[model samples]
Target: MDASRQIAARIEFLRRQLVDREPGPLRDAYLAVPTRERPVLQGTTTPALTQIWQQRPSGLITPATAETQPIDLIDVYLTFEEIFGFAAGPAYPVKQLQALPLGFVLQFCAELLNALSRPGASHSDVDRAFATQWLKEPIRTRVLNELRDPRRALVVPQALMLLARAAVEHSPDSLPDGAKPGNLIGALLAFSDMIGPSGEGGPTVLGEQPGDLGREVIANQYFNNNASVPHTFARYVRRWRELPQQFAGKDGLVDLPAVYEQCTGVTLDDLTVVAGALWAAACNGNVLTPTAELETLLPAGQVAKVLALISADLETLRQAVQSERARRHTEWTFDAFQQRPVIRLGAFLLVMDQRHLIDRAFGWLPILDVRFPPDTHPRPTNHEKLAGQAIRTLRRFSELYVSEVLHSITGQGTTTRRVYDDPELKAAFQGEGQKIADAAVDYGDTWVVVEVTTSQLQRDAATAVPGNAQVKDIDKLLEEVRQIDATIQALRRDESRLTGVSSQIRRRYLPLLLLTEGFPVNPVSMTVIRERAHKRGLLQGQDVMPLEVIDVEELEWIEALQEQQGVSLLAVVQRKQASSLERTSMRSFLADTITTPLSHPQRFEGKVSKALGPLEAVLLKRKQREP
Candidate 1:
């Protein structure tokens, strides 16, 4: 396709990829990235992280425990599970690591060092022939976690020499057995596959020679900078803003960030972010005719903006890029490059942003309709629909589990109206474009308002959040409440979904329940949930109206039991009979134990404003339009 048509196609692709946001300051606000802090467990490094190398279970490829996993697996655990002291993830370049097997790590390290220490020619990362090569597979592979080159720079060779010198001085035994001055040379050759039949590259090899930094080489000291905070992300944000021109000027595609850094002195944590952002911004969107606002900021004004960008906080740059993306929005791209989405510059930026986003994209990005005033641009993930499914399951199963417990206790019959499913109720609550409660339960006369919610925890804690994530504190835990709060307001107006339930109960209590992936085990977390829920208005009558979130695991276990027994709650009640545990009412289980209501003083509130009140007027308009 021609350039104009190509740009149009790209804009369309972006529209499908990114949710729309308000324009101007509001859009800027929504585009900001949130800060994240990762938690780590003690006793994880050393032989523990490299247990796979130290004791590969001849037949077992996976590590025995998370602690004994490879550095790659362990790093993911550190972020996804917060099992290690790692505060955030993508762990930023893996330039340096303490827990990886020395052999595997050394292979890459040696390649990086040799590329750097070469004497004659200045090996630049820019010109592939001179620095490095640029390929689509590299971008795609890196984003998907297949490319493992850490510290994309060739500074390793310089650093390696320093390490070798230290090893020789401190303790000779620490060097590889019978090692010589050329040990680094040998390592470089072996790891780079220089000795192969074709004298070309090959796969990485792992063994004892590359295992430890020699026993004397302190693991922690070898990579003191491993745990240091990464700042390349800020530079990547700056790079993202300058992409359209740079990418277009540099041919159909741009070289990787290491090449950029080698030539321009800028650093890139994840090249994919550079590519992803480029796509989200210029190539993926219709920027052929700059927005009127962008036109005004060009040439004369653009220079100042660029200058301001240099010192601009990470959040500011992020908001600017996001705002630009929205301004350039048009339609989805119908064009393809080898069946892959193409933007001369877009592909590169999209790749970079995808690699970066799971760690630093805009915070708590709810899918299209579930948006609120306080946040925008929820991090894109493969888990959105799954999160919804999980919540639905928990709501249904939790209702059944609690209802069964109640029946065994009071001997009073309980009924559940899958009310939202009833045709009459659907008409009442969802006329044309409306939403309703996920599920409902009626325990004798006391009807409970159960609101089931599940938000995807950070798919990539390090780069998933958006904006200048440096300043924006995007707490996954905080996001849980933010999501709950967004859906909670519906409850105040959602009673209509239950019009099918012919209940003449004089008294009704709202037992608001929220559910998300994973169990809340931390007392502090429980406190935050309680406090945040109350602050958002779930804080009404503490005793009578129990407001608690569900522990997905607990309900999941109960869900499994029902499947195994191949019977409904009634049959299980009949078989087990009424024991003391059975006597424990579902109300007590939900209101008293399972949930942490608002009255409890565990107020862990973050500085976030309430979301816009439920779009009542919008819903009303839709209802009016319906027959």
Candidate 2:
């Protein structure tokens, strides 16, 4: 459901209108009327009433009133856009989409694209209009299913504008001087593409398909701007470029279509879906651009300045984090790693996840004082053996921690037991190839299958396979949870006695995978994992619980552990929904304790400048000394 690639494509489209590094027009130049222009219409431009009257059914407009009719084509299209709710610019709210039929948007976009490609006869040179049509339900369902949400759905209008504008901006020569795309690039092109490629369907006016549009667009985008789209796209393109024999011919031109198919798995029925998926992931919201907050705002524009500010903002944040880390000293003991009351692994996971650096933090796990026994902390030697024991002690503590927390929450009726107690299941897991659940809990009419995991083994975040080549570590971990959930479901269906539930009891299975990031990634990124699994027809049901990566207040947990002798699981889960992170308390805790020089924009700018000033001065001095 991530819209990274689509976002990338949109950004590339916008880059034509925005992201200019040169000294040029602040406003979009395409909106301005060209000094020298030729008329697209064959004859003198007539009033709107005359145009619609000509197309009117036999008796709708009589000679008595035809010439005097006040209706306008602009009014008609505007009403259509409003009623149907396909605005030519920006995203519409999910609430606004309720009135639209399912397939209408896609059908509209197709028509608009077609109309733009092969323009029709209009009375004005600036005529950019569409033939009217209704959206169907089936196409809407199909597009929605492929897209997964309204965010990408709303991008359809923006997509049309991006494409139409990019076509004009980048391939100006290709657009016919007479049939120029009008000032209403946002609205008219949106309607044009909605209609169809050439408005050639049964209800359409059917013109010759603009075959050259495809070639011109693809070539212009791919070759221009040092490769249009995200820089990440270049890496995908490089995959085929590196292995020329597999995809390229002796003539040396790479088979782009094959490469795209090979890289992203674009098939027909799911072409929209696959492309949407890749785009969502590629142009993921996590990947920030300078004008990300107000991407549409212009005139009093600051978009071009954003790229530099982003670098400054990031550097500022990095320095601030490093400073906070220096001052962040906990009185809690790591020596207690051997003891059950140890540092909260849950708290550790939550903090690192806030900065999107869990995997990197996990990779640095060996640096922890707990890795060695308390006895070995001061003068550590032969650490491997001690570290092994530490890991076992910590793991046992984590298991016990979960058991205790659940015991408090569920009271007497329900029980959460580590599945390791089951001899048969434990033996099955030990059997060379089999898998088993980490824990199982009985909680008020539900059998919760638990799988605990960390990206501790994830060395390279860039690789598809985190721990093993055959499976992503997270997927492998979740598979075991799913299997256990399924097994419980089957057993309940067949009347088997699970620990807390009797043979007569009916309990639905809820599979919970407590996943912690080992590498830095967006907190919402776990959806990419679940979605990818669902796309492959695995993990596709309401029975599968959402991957729980809830963020808890690290400081509150620390306070409770330090003073109240416990960290509350109920409190942690209650603080946020699964995959939702609230960094307010965490940030407040840090700010109250630390200087936080880069927290606000003005201060952040001042700090960044100050940090850079010294470095720049030193570098200049070094250069002078060298000369």
Candidate 3:
């Protein structure tokens, strides 16, 4: 009989005896069943218990009904097979599949199958596969799923981190792939943003504990392994870089918590994961500042584990960064060259112009051109454009600057030395006449003058010259000179109007001065104070003293009348208050007009006296009016 049939047959024979029940018969019948069915026959599955209800010949269930029903042996074995295919070790024969409790057996078998599949696979490939799947069905879907267990949803990001960490530890490609997978990163960030503000339940990212398996895996590979960590570290460092001074806290960094709270939704979670990733990454030989405040909450032993992991990964990250840096420099150099290619056919004209201009202006020796064959030229396609394209191709490198190339050519700060030193560029212009003559050639008794102008000269030495100076005719050049002169004169006049720095000391704040009185300080003192404030960037750098002052006689009269009525008139009126007072007065006037308060003689007199300031007091005295 098949295994399921045999087990079932044994169960049936035991059920018959349970109904008949004789001690000697029961013992013998239990022994008759197979070893696998023995436990069922005895009804002693761990924490031993017996069936309370059973089927019987009568309508009601007795012990016999429960016993005769017979467990679905086929379904039980099929469920076990469906859950876990493997039985034991990697090399264990599949033919030796044995029976065991379903849940326990499945756990062991699934783990074994996974291990068997992992052998020669790379981390990057695994990361890519996971990322593809994640992008299509991200954790956000699960987080939003109404039917999902909240605890399971909460741990999804950690699970992703776990897989990423495994790849990072075992495979170099995995770290790079995981770091650059924008879709996966975006989903993770979105989920984190949603959770950050909720602040309910456990932390989403794993901490450094054995129980925190996800974090441990990330730590082991990112920090402890030989792969570089900056790929991970950049996840955080970019945020804090170039932080504004005023926004920074007492620690010289922005208050992360407050900033995070202001950012609603999934953003807060993104910040946490990014910060954690960066911390781990930087520990692996990256150059970002190790902010200690972030690490203070972690346990002591985990810190040591992290440090060890970083030590292991440092070299890999270092090499990767170095390779990237060198690649960047190369592309930058190529672009600078392309943007300003060396002079080929037209170099002589530029040389001539430089010599002529300098000799005429300052009587200096001519600057020599670096010699090369006429054909020795930069690529017909711009060298700089090619370099720029190449440099831009690099994913994370910062662009190259002119200063970097200048440093490579003549050490740091050489452009200043080359352009401004001693003879000055003006002195080189006079020798242009010599350059024009040398570049000319005679053909068989026919004389021809090759036109050598500053434009041609500029093209020749574009790479070397700081400014693009090509000699145009007197009119255009004269116009340029006039524009420059005008600009300089304007600047000088503006400078003369500005107050000296010493004025800052003279206009210093005077303590105990009556603030409401608008203290009668000197005009110069007020002007200087205003100017100083403008220079120091206070009041948005507005020169209060320079602004025109105007008087509002109507407002002054109204204010004076208020003061005469015994109201404090020191109020510095504001727009909001003025609007409110206007609204109230209009409402009061309308209400009084509508009610006809003047109909009562005493009330009318009283209202008139209050509004006209004691006018009614004079009018009411009949004797005083009898003149």
Candidate 4:
């Protein structure tokens, strides 16, 4: 048989073996198999296998249904190694195997089996084949090359165009009617905070037992960067509040709890209390029964409602896992915790229905819940059109945020949306209307020209696919870079026309592109930008400074650094521009250059609190009114 058919047959055979067996016996059988005899199973753990087996429903794992159960790649590898008796080579890490999709894992195993069947295939030959597939060089390189293709058109649609499309697609009646998106978002953020470790009564401490110490260490590593979540929440809240309320209800008087009730059929307070209880239970143990303390905190009805919203049954989870695995066949990225079907789809709780094997209870995986608004809502009718609108909204907010930060640092002299009024400059951009820089900051002799973009790297760009999506995302970013270069060129062409800056001092210009989302600022992208700039004659002049691309995270860090130490953004930019290494990202550059420690958490939380103060107050008032 061919490789594909061989894999399918192998999986079928394995499924039959596992179908009639109980989870505990199956787990014991698997663990009893000596790893010395089957070296490929070296990294497989008892806990991981037990977790996988527990996902199988009681009395439901018939021969017909066994194939439908979610298959962990590690389990497959172990099964194949035990059966085939392939020569033991280097063992793949459990984490690495776990990250791969079902399809990829099946193919990998099939390839291994095929190699072992070959006449003269030695250990080195099998290792070479393994390395090739594991690294994914062949596919990844093809995708990257396709992204650099020059023939691809780089046309980006305007905000108005997208808005018009959305309007055409959905009538006013079809738009979101129940809750204001802003209020709903605010309530969700508060709910997220309530369940977090740093919620209500400070950080929760895992016990001092031997096993607990490891758990505590893992939790600390993950949660140490506490500022990220709050900052993200604050940014989203600000963006949603500032954006035009195209989807919100007309009255706009919906409170936080009302919004939660409208969407979830439960009050935000009840949801928060229940979510906290579940979070606590999850932290304490992998599986927990409904306890007296949890019941005391929330009534049965409320608990059931909250569980319905956030938890899924084994079958539902299996389907979701299958769907996700299929979706990720093209998109190679993986975060085991974040990308788990239940977690990714806004369901953090897992309910095990097999009372015969284990008590009918909830199973908690150590995964952080980081679901966004869209994850909770129904999939939009037109995702592409709505995404465009979202991108435009983010771009506007990013520009505003960057301008405000600049104003704070350089004083009110920082000019935003400055029009090119010079006769020649106006004529140059006549066909495209008046050209304008997003913002310009004046620092005596130094002038900073800013361009803010919210262009994010698309999944296709990250995946091993030579598709249109990859090309389009790359083209959109390059187009933004081109615009930045053009603005810098225009400003330098006529220094006399520069507005809101002192004309007396000889000025040096710094070109900056501020991205709302992180972009790969590696050698390839930088080289591409430089090549494009050279073609446009933007880099020919000695006085011109190379453009710097920094994300909002770096901008926040810089702002904090400025407040703590007397470090200026201009100084950082100058140092980076002068550096011989062209591949390093702004974050790396900051880490290498800065000696003083940054008080990022303090400054970030302060800023978020200030930004979210009014909304938070309103939420608190609503909670206080609750009986």
Best by TM-score: 4
**Over the stretch 273-368, how does candidate 1's per-residue lDDT look in tens digits?**
232222234323222221232222233343222222121222332344344343321111111110111112211111111111222221111111
Q: What is the C-alpha RMSD of each candidate to the true structure, in Å?
A: 29.4, 29.3, 39.9, 25.8
Error of 1 at 77 (Å): 18
Write one digit per residue (lDDT tens) for candidate 3, span 1-627.
Answer: 899999999998865645334454444444333342233334322222344454333223545332222121101111111113323232121111111221222222222222222323333333334334433444424323421321111212222222222222222222332343222333222322222111112234322111222222212222111111221122122222222123344323333323322222112233232223333233332213233422343333433332222121323432433444433311111121111111111111001111111121111010011011012223323434433332222111111111111122222221111211112212322244211111111111111111111211122111111111111211222232232223223222331222121122212110001111011122222233334434434323121112111111112222332333322111222221233222122122222223332122111223222322222332344336476
Which window of ten consecutive residues has the lowest lDDT sum in model 3? 508-517
Better of 1 and 4 by TM-score: 4
Candidate with more favorable, higher lDDT: 1 or 3:
1
- How far does residue 340 in candidate 3 sit from its true spot (Å)? 35
lDDT digits (tens) for residues 1-627 of candidate 4: 899999999887765554334455554455333343223233333322211222332222223322322111101111112222332222222223233332222222323333332323343444344334433455434433432432211111111111111221221222234532222112211222222121112123312111222222222222211124344534544444433333333333213223335444555455445544443333343223443444455566766665555554444434544455555533232222123212211223321111101101111111011112224445445544444444444455556656656655543223222333224344444445445556666555666767677676565454423334433554576566555556666666555555634277556777777777566564444554555556656545666678787777677777776667666788777877666443446776776667777766233456545434443554566568679
Task: Report the Cα lDDT for candidate 2.
Answer: 0.31
Residue-level lDDT for 336 in candidate 3: 17
**lDDT tens readout by residue for model 2, 117-208:** 22131211112112112234554444334333211222232244333222222222223345533333234335333432221122122122
Query: What lDDT is reached at residue 442 by model 4?
Result: 54
Candidate 4: worst-modelled 10 consecutive residues by lDDT: 355-364
When 2 and 3 are scored with TM-score, the better candidate is: 2
TM-score of 2: 0.28
Please provide TM-scores, in order, for all candidate models, with all chains considered together: 0.26, 0.28, 0.13, 0.47
The candidate, 3 or 4, that scores higher on lDDT is: 4
Q: In model 3, state the lDDT of residue 446.
A: 15
Best by lDDT: 4
How much lDDT does each candidate structure score? Answer: 0.29, 0.31, 0.24, 0.42
